[model samples]
Target: MDNIKLFSEPIADATPVIELFDVGMHYDSGEEILSDVNISINKGEFYFLTGASGAGKTTLLKLLYLAHPPSRGHIKLFKHDLHYKDRDAMAKVRRKIGVVFQDYKLIETMSVLDNVALSLRILGRSEKYIEKNVPSLLHWVGLGNHMHNKPATLSGGQKQRVAIARAIVNKPDVLIADEPTGNVDPRMAQRLLHLFKELNKYGTTVIVASHNTELVNTFAFPRLHLEDGKLIKYNAGSIWTLFDKKGDVNV
Candidate 1:
């Protein structure tokens, strides 16, 4: 823990965008999914959540986007404590965080353009505004020609791109991606990462949960490593490294 402190001192004058203290989650079956997790992710930073299947990566992500409340401990996002159960306050916070799921949770019945514009539409933006922005965002994600196509008609990569376009169309302050490159080719995966990097450069905090070691290593982002539902390692600087329980490092 001291070593973690040594490497994780916050940047001067920068406030953390997300903070978790002794966070834990468990199920009705009394099975612990996460325990004693502590982390702070500052604005504009990028991190890879690397762990095996069932290591609670998705659960932890759910906590970030406010999909679920932790069974214990505290979580603060954008400087607001999640302990406050005010619906209006929570909704306001959620409006600033965009999430991209692994399944590309687009509406199968809606056209790609409609799906991408859903957020703005819900916000009561005018059709004129939606019309102007959706296509441009689609074009940026390489889906310009496919805007009218339904999710059922798009390829895996195309669907992922659509998901990304939808998530960022409103220009949220934080973007959370779960296994974003899971179904794409390596080249497309890198392209997707490049997109995230570009967004990060524009000041969006990005957190990607993935098990793809090659991509994780290649990107050289700081990492939060989970094991058996516990955050065992947090490296905020230097190249990413995976360490086993025996303390053997894999670079």
Candidate 2:
């Protein structure tokens, strides 16, 4: 844990994994994207967030992942009030969190194993430790034989799995995935979803966002629906019950 940053201040022993209190986001050009978003993601919870394009799902994820600060309200994670933390402290928080963007942000030049092991190296893990962990994780994600292969050489589903393995390699307490199954076939997409489910079973708080109705409908997890910067809850029988007057998602 040498490269892992220590918190600037210690926590008082009680806090949700993530707590957003009336949080909102406003752009510099006077556009409001999120308004009064108050939610708490407890430890080891699995949640799905689905909405149409530009419905603020990604924005909400960005805030939760600490990519950017909200324009209004407070965010607390692991009992650490983010408002009181500096940049250094934020980095530490990020270390315990893992994220998978829709774009599959992999190093095209690096082999699958190398790319997956990059994060551990960044955290100053010993060479022996990284060597032991990298191949093991690649195999876990079904990429062990392809360790020497780069991203461009892999299939869309394979790339997604590589991204997932990289995200979880550090053993983060939480994982956030945005449109992780968007580019693959239905069967492959289902496989990827199962990977997320398996990760959750291992005690990682998991949140996934996708506009894929058929895909999400197969699972009985709670869903957070978004529309025109507004939020709605998803329940049984139908996932499309929240598109009234606010917004609609065809998927």
Per-residue lDDT over 1-251 for candidate 1, one digit per residue giving the tens place of the 0 to 100 score: 01111112333436788988778899999999887777778887888888999989999999999998999989989998875579999999999999999999999999999999988989999999898878877877788899999999988899999999888887888899999999999998998998887777667889999999888888867778888775655565554454543323221
Query: Where in model 2 is the C-alpha error above 4 Å?
Result: 1-15, 236-251
TM-score of candidate 2 on Cα atoms, chains taken together: 0.87
Clashing pairs in 2: none
Query: Model 1 RMSD to the real structure?
Result: 7.8
- The Cα local distance difference test for each model comes to 0.83, 0.81
**Where is model 1 more than 4 Å wrong at Cα?**
1-13, 234-251
- Single out the weakest 10-residue window by summed lDDT for candidate 2: 1-10
lDDT accuracy of residue 149 in candidate 1: 97
Query: What TM-score goes with each of the models?
Result: 0.87, 0.87
Using lDDT as the measure, which candidate wins?
1
| lDDT string, candidate 2, 1-251, tens digits | 02222112222322368887778898899899987777777777778998899889999999999888899988888878895448788889999999997889999999998888899989899999888777777776777789999899999999999999889988888899999999999999998998888777666788899999999989878788887687777764555465444332222
